[model samples]
Target: MSWYNTSARQLPWRDPGTDPWAILVCEVMSQQTPIARVLPAWEEWMARWPDPTALAEASPAHVIIAWGTLGYPRRALRLQECAGVVVEKWDGTLPRSREDLLSLPGIGPYTADAIIAFAYRERTTVLDVNVRRVLARIYGEAAPPTSLKAWEVERASHLVPDDGEAASQWNAAIMELGALICTARNPRCEQCPIAPHCAWLKLGKPEAATPRKVQAFEGTHRQARGKVMRVLRTAHAPIGVEELRERSGLPEVRFEPALTTLLADGLAAATPGGIQLPIE
Candidate 1:
């Protein structure tokens, strides 16, 4: 906590006056995306849609365009869907309960806990990849499991402070510690405040029995989809499907499935003229 108080990054959403909606946006944008990349995008997004009402009313085309290079464009649409639900069902106010938050689109366990802890300042185990790694090392595991376990959740829950404010700070501090010091690769243990207490250090830092798998991006269908979406996002008007595919510069095999999935996912639409981003 002491280290976090002085060394935590000055993220805009961490500001004292930031509201729950802004925190929700930050959490969504930060998922699988680096904080550096998310920072500018998040700022522009919040400025464009400061509240649920604003986001709910935003056009799908505008939302996808504003989402820019954030790899998982579907999350952007899900966020808009969440905002719509918040507006229509909750009177434009984010719900305080975990169950209620989980009911919102794109929100899962980690996000729900985060909103509870960071937004509402509640006592909840807010587990993310960083926090999970930090806890795994502290307890002598070389790495966290491929998927979260019941035991992990129970252990993390027990570690939370009883008081809401203290618990929130603990959650933030531990997550920051993991992000900055106890990183997944080449951890800076010498400067870590919890280095003295970390069990993995005492155990000689054994490697994980199974190394994590890294997915390849080049030439993947996902990459092709991104290329297609980029063209559609920048287009002022619909373009013919074949023209759009040629413009994407993807081979026919990659382009066909990419376009099919984009249209199926509702990320793009086929208009009377041609294909473009969803205007609705």
Candidate 2:
């Protein structure tokens, strides 16, 4: 906790007394997107939505536009859907229990547990990438595996502090440690707060056999979809289906899936004249 107090980034989501809904948004936005990109988007997103009731009343198109190049736009749709439930069923107060949170759309075990620990300050484990890396280095004595094993989860669960306040502090502390000093690439082991206890460091710090690859963006269907979204977001009127195809410039093979995704995810609506963002 001391190390995290000194070393942790002053991220907005981690600010004192942040709302549970905001924490949920942070967890979802940061799932696949990098934190650097998520920060500004989060600020804009909070300013726009502010609460679940506000987001539930928002148009799907507006939600997608607010997402803006975070990638995996479907998550934006899911977040809106989740907000609807929070407002309609829970009366805009996100449920405090883990089971209730997990039942919400886009709330998986990790996200549910995170909300419990970070937002509610409940005794719960947050097994995010950062926490996993720290645990792997300390106990497993190796680089964190790409896929979490059952044993790893079991071992980690036991480490969660039984007390609510202590658990929250410990959870945040480990995550901050892994994200900074115990980083995946170029870990600063010398300055690590728990380096003396890190088994991987004692074993000479071997690297993972395979390095993670960055996904290609150019000419991919995802890029085509993004282009399509940008056009729809900025358009004053609906665009013809034919015009959308030309504007997206995607091959028939790529175009079909991207268009289907936009429609299926409710990012676009087909009117008699053309296609545009969903109407409020």
Candidate 3:
């Protein structure tokens, strides 16, 4: 907590008065996307839709277009769905309990726990990949990163401070530590706050027994999907199939599967003339 007070990044989402909805947006946008990009989009999103009710009332195409180049366009659709639930079911007030938050579209264990801890001021564990790595390196003899046995929630639940304030700070601190110093590649051990007691350091930092594999992003369905979403984001009207193909830089390839996926995910819509983002 002391380290966090002195070193935490000055982010809009960390503002003392940031509301639950904004926090939820930040968490969702930050998933598999850099905070640098998430920041601008979040600001615009909040400016346009200050609450769940506003977001729920917006057109899906507007939301997707506003989501911009954040890659996973489906997250925008899910976020909109989540907003609708919050507005319709919870009256625009985000749930205070983990179970209810988890019941919302796109809300999962980690997100639910974060809402509980950060927004609700309850003692709860937040276990992102960074937190996972930090914990695995710290109390590792008992639970190494390699040991594929148990669950993160169960393990992380035990480490949080009993008090709400300290617990939230601890969650943020550990995650920041991992992201800034204890990085996946070339950790800055000297700058680490807990370096003196880090088990990985003591053990000379052995390589992973089975290294994690990196998935290809380029030349994959994800790339094609992103391409399609990008086209829709910039279009003023529904784009024809041929136009979509030409704009997508894949004129020879048929994107029927991608279009179907976009429709199913509620990220796009079909029109008589062409395909477009969902109508309001």
TM-score of each: 0.99, 0.93, 0.94
Instruction: Flag the better candidate by lDDT, 1 or 3.
Output: 1
Report the lDDT of model 3 for residue 2.
Answer: 71
Highest TM-score scorer: 1
Predicted structure 3: clash tally = 0
lDDT tens per residue, model 3, 92-124: 999998889999999998899888877877898
Model 1 clash pairs are none
For each predicted model, how many residue pairs clash, with residues at least 3 apart or on different chains?
0, 0, 0
TM-score of 1: 0.99
Give the per-residue lDDT digits (tens) of candidate 1, residues 1-280.
9999999999999987689999999999999999999999999999889999999999999999999998899999999999999999999999999999999999999999999999999899998999999999999999999999999999999989999999999999999998899999999999999999999999999899999988999989899999999999889999998899899999898999999999999899999999999989
What lDDT is obtained when candidate 1 is compared to the true structure? 0.95
RMSD of 1: 0.7
Residue 275 of model 1, lDDT score = 97
Candidates 2 and 3 compared by lDDT, better number: 2
Candidate 2 lDDT by residue in tens digits, 52-136: 9999999887888889889888788899989999998999999999889989998898999999999999998789888898998
Instruction: Give candidates' CA RMSD values in order.
Output: 0.7, 1.8, 2.1
